[model samples]
Target chain A: MATMTIAKAITSGLRAVLADDPKTLIMGEDIGKLGGVYRVTEGLQAEFGADRVVDTPLAESGILGTAIGLSFRGYRPICEIQFDGFVFPAFNQITTQLAKIRSRSSGMLSAPVVIRIPYGGGIGSIEHHSESPEALFAHTAGLRIITPSNPHDAYWMTQQAVACQDPVIIFEPKRRYWLKGEVDTESAGRDAFSAQVVREGTDVTIVAYGPLVPVALAAAEAAQEDGNSVEVIDLRSISPIDFDTVTASVEKTGRLIVTHEAPTFGGIGGEIAARVAERAFLSMEAPVLRVGGFHMPYPLAKVEEQYLPDIDRLLEALDRSLAY
Target chain B: MGAEHLPASEFDIEELEQSLVTSDPADAPPLVQLMAPDGSLREDTKYGHYAAHLDGEALRAMYRDMALVRRFDQEATALQRQGQLLLWPPLLGQEAAQIGSGTALQAQDYVFPTYREHGVALTRGLELSKVLRLFRGVSNGGWDPRESNFHLYTLVLAAQSLHAVGYAMGVQRDGDDAVTVAYFGDGASSEGDVHESMVFAASNQSPVVFFCQNNHWAISVPTEVQSRIPLSNRASGYGFPGVRVDGNDVVAVHAVTRWALERARSGKGPVLIEAFTYRMSAHTTADDPTKYRELAEEEKWRERDPLLRLERYLRSTNTAGQDFFDQIAAEADKLAASTRADVLAMEAPDFEDHFANVYAEPHPLIREELEWHRQYQAGFAEETAGQAEGEAR
Candidate 1:
């Protein structure tokens, strides 16, 4: 076990994959010398050489398009989209090409490309840098979308994403990059697609993922003081959501609140809420609630704290579920 | 007409810019032609040597490929008209551009073709009948790309350009000599993906050939709307050589494509070859060319028909006798019959197959949905059985 930040763990994981497979390559804008804008890939170019770690032309479509091609040649390419909002330039390539190639070709072709994006707002940055677009990707069928809340999962998930045959999008929580935790390098406790109960309780169930996992845990701790035993579940993968874990937890708690950094309307939370209502309706003591951003766009950084879902918003939802 | 609104001067900046954009077919760039439209072999200093090695048998084979693909194309169009297929994109006038470049590729070379490259598909050794599976609505993709080193046809224009470059980059990484060919039309040239594809290919020095079959029209839009200058001229801006060839001349397209492929394979960087041809038929079965184009223009293009010119060359050169032509005609008829038979016999795959190929990994939702579908299908079978039993009683 080693203590490291989520960013460091991802970097370490990438290095290990590069060393293990000569066919693995890392490509992105400013990723080589600059070590990525957030320094997630710092010192990687030096260790792996420029061929393995490439600084591509500043075009997202090119990065993804070429990544698709490289996969055809039997090389696994990991692309880094600088920010969540900036990924739009490559949206056509992703939603149309990468996501459909396998099914379009009827399993004849597989693109094992990993697209890493630093998502969600908390750094008080400018526009385009602080947006959570996980729902948009999760809506696409062929892609496997995963997010790591801590160093342990980040380490293993990064490696697992490369190994998977399907193209994967890893929505790295920019706000949690520096959060330190012990990562067991030897073992990955669970598969990349499954959800895990980070904290166990019984009164209310808080289902969160990516940037909101820590917020859910904090809300659970506060609810404990209020004599509420809240269970917090961290959803690792967003697309093929591990509903079994969420349903099992809801069966025990009889109350559920789904939260995320994206807006509530047409968000991942709504999908989870709808599914849980169907699966665990008999055990439900209260209506399933969603706590997330507003329907509007991610606002200016000065007032983003109000737009983002934090511990207070989660607690308010918990209170409503308990009162019902 | 008002004096001020009358016109700009001939040498005015606006007039000069307008002159750069030509709708006139006569104002095309210099072309490399090994076989002239009059059925005679023309001499070219730079590219002539590439075609010099073509023996009588090689020439005859090229003619055979062009004729067979044209026949297959006619059959597919007929199938669409007969309601046997949903849609078909005719490669009527652009046969030489597809066959010439396609036949030039080595077995190891990869091809990324646009949706209308039926001739290219034929040259790549694809089961010509499988191409109809897409039009027949039986499958999204008809054949395995790995078996032929030919990618599935890209419907979204210019999207495959990037894939071709990326594949070439992979070849470079693997230290292999194989080059990749990406085929697109003049309309696809306007896409941003093409710009990025060229930039990456240039920067990486990837071994890729961007073969743009300039079929004059991208549906209703002309080549003039896509670019002010010749499409090949755009390559010079991207730090690579571009060549314009007589697309109707099979020998020229073959020679030019061979030269470009060799240049790319030798690590000389990417090259762009613009095969200036014409779309002799409607874009697809769904399109109406009479609504958008003039008959006189079609007549002018008919004079330079690729098949006719090749036949003229073969007869004039005494490379093929009347017997060879008669045999080829008979073969085309047989091929057309088989293609029609094959398309009519195609069966739709199992419904569960749709859910199965969505993801390479074991996705829970796909699994659950597939399981539900199985149960739902079984329930219907049980109901039918019960109904039959009740009727017997």
Candidate 2:
């Protein structure tokens, strides 16, 4: 085991995947000598040479389109979109081409491509940089969306995403990049799709993912003051959400509160709330609640605190669940 | 140029801007022609020898390929009219552009084609009946691309251009001499992905050939809307050679495509070949060219039909006799008849295949959904059986 930040863990994970398979390559803008905007790929080009770790021209569509071609040629290319909002330029390629090619080919071809985007907001960044657009991709089928909240998952899930034959979008919580944790490089404790239970409780279940896992844990800890035991489940995968795990937890806790940094309407939390309600209806103690951003755009950095769902919001939701 | 932003005293910005805005096809690169539209062979110093090795048998085979695919296209259109196919994209006049470039490719070369390359699919040894499965509504894709080195047809215009460049980059990395050919049309050339494809191919020096069949129309809109200049000239802006060929001339297209493929495979970077042709039919079964084009314009292009030109050249050179033409016609009819049978006999795949292969790895949700679907289907079967027993009672 080694102690490192989520950013370093992802870097290490990329390095390990490159070393594991010679066919694997890394491509993005400013990812070579300048190391990436966040320095996640620092020193990689020097190690892997310019061919494997390419610093591509500043076009998101070109990066993804060529990566799809590379995948067709048997190259496992891991593409990095510099930020969350910038992914829209490549959205057509991702949702239409990359996601549909597998079914379109009728099992003849599979693109083992991994797209990594540092998503979610909490660092007081600018407008486009600080947006969690995971819900947009989650709605598309044939895509696997995974986000790792800690260094351990960041390391293992990054490798898992590269190994996956289906095109995967790794929504790395940009806000948790500096959060340090121990990662056992030798063994992956779980698969990339399963929702993990970080805290054990019997009163109410709090479901979160990506940047919100830490917030949920903090909320669970604060709930002890009210003598309300809360269980926190980190939803690792967004597309094929592990409803079984969440449903199991909901069956036990009987009350569920799903939260995220994305908008509450038409968000991942809404899907989770609906599914848990359907699957565990008889065991319910209260209607499933959701706490997330508002319907409007990610607001100006000054008022983002009020816009983001904080621990107070989770506690309030928890209070509503207990009241019910 | 950076000099455009300079002061007037330093640079003639107004003159340069005027020259840049002015686009005349006559000013574009000279068109490559080895065969005149009247079926006369012309001698060219550069590309004439590329077709010099083709003996009488090879010329006859090329004629047979074009004739057969044209017949197959007609049959498919007939099937669509009969309601056997959902839709069919006819490659009526662009046969030479497809077969000539497609046959020029070596077995190792890969092809990325737009949806109307049935002739190219033939050159790749893909079963023509399989192509009908897509139109028959039985499959989205009907063949294994790995078997033919020909990717499934891309319908979203010009999207496959970048994929072709990237595959060529992979070939470069693998130290292979095979060139990847991307087939699009004049209308698709206007897409940004095509521009980026050229930039990436040029930047990486990837072995790729951009084969654009200027079929004159993108559905209702004419090629003029896509480019004010000849589509071939766009390659010059990206630092590569671009050649405009008489798309109706098979010999010229084959020769030019061969030259471009050789140049790319030899690491001379990418080349763009614009095959100037016309769409003799609607864009697809859904389109009506009469709404946007004139019968006089269609008649003018009919005089330069690719199949007729090839046949004239064959007869003038005594490369094929009347017996050979009759034999090829009989063979084409037989093949078309068999294809109709095969398409009619094609079956809808089992439901299991539908849920399968969406992901290579087993997905829990897919597994659960498949199971639920099985149970749902079983409920219907049980309901019918129970009703049958009630009738017996």
Model 2 root mean square deviation, Cα atoms: 3.5
Over the stretch B1-393, how does candidate 1's per-residue lDDT look in tens digits?
001122457348875776665355334568989988999888899998888888889889989999999999999999999999999999999999988999899999999998998899989999899889999999988899999998998898888999999999999988899999999999999999999999999888889999999999999999999998899988887888999999999999999999999999898889999999999999999999999899999999999999999899889989888999999999999999999999989987888889988999889999899899999999999999999999999
Question: Model 2: how many Å of interface RMSD?
Answer: 4.2
Alpha carbon lDDT of residue B116, candidate 2?
A: 96
RMSD of each: 6.6, 3.5
Tell me, by lDDT, which candidate is best.
1
* Top candidate when judged by DockQ against the true structure: 2
TM-score of the candidate numbered 2? 0.96
Q: Could you tell me which residue pairs clash in candidate 1?
A: none
| Cα DockQ of the candidate 2 complex | 0.54
Per-residue C-alpha lDDT of model 1 across residues A1-324, encoded as one tens digit per residue:
999999999999999999999999999999998999999889999998888899888999999999999998999999999999999989999999999999989998999999999999999999999999999989999999999999999999999999999999999999999999999999998899999999999999999998889999999999999999999999999988999999999999999999998999999989998999889999999999999889898899999999988899888888899999
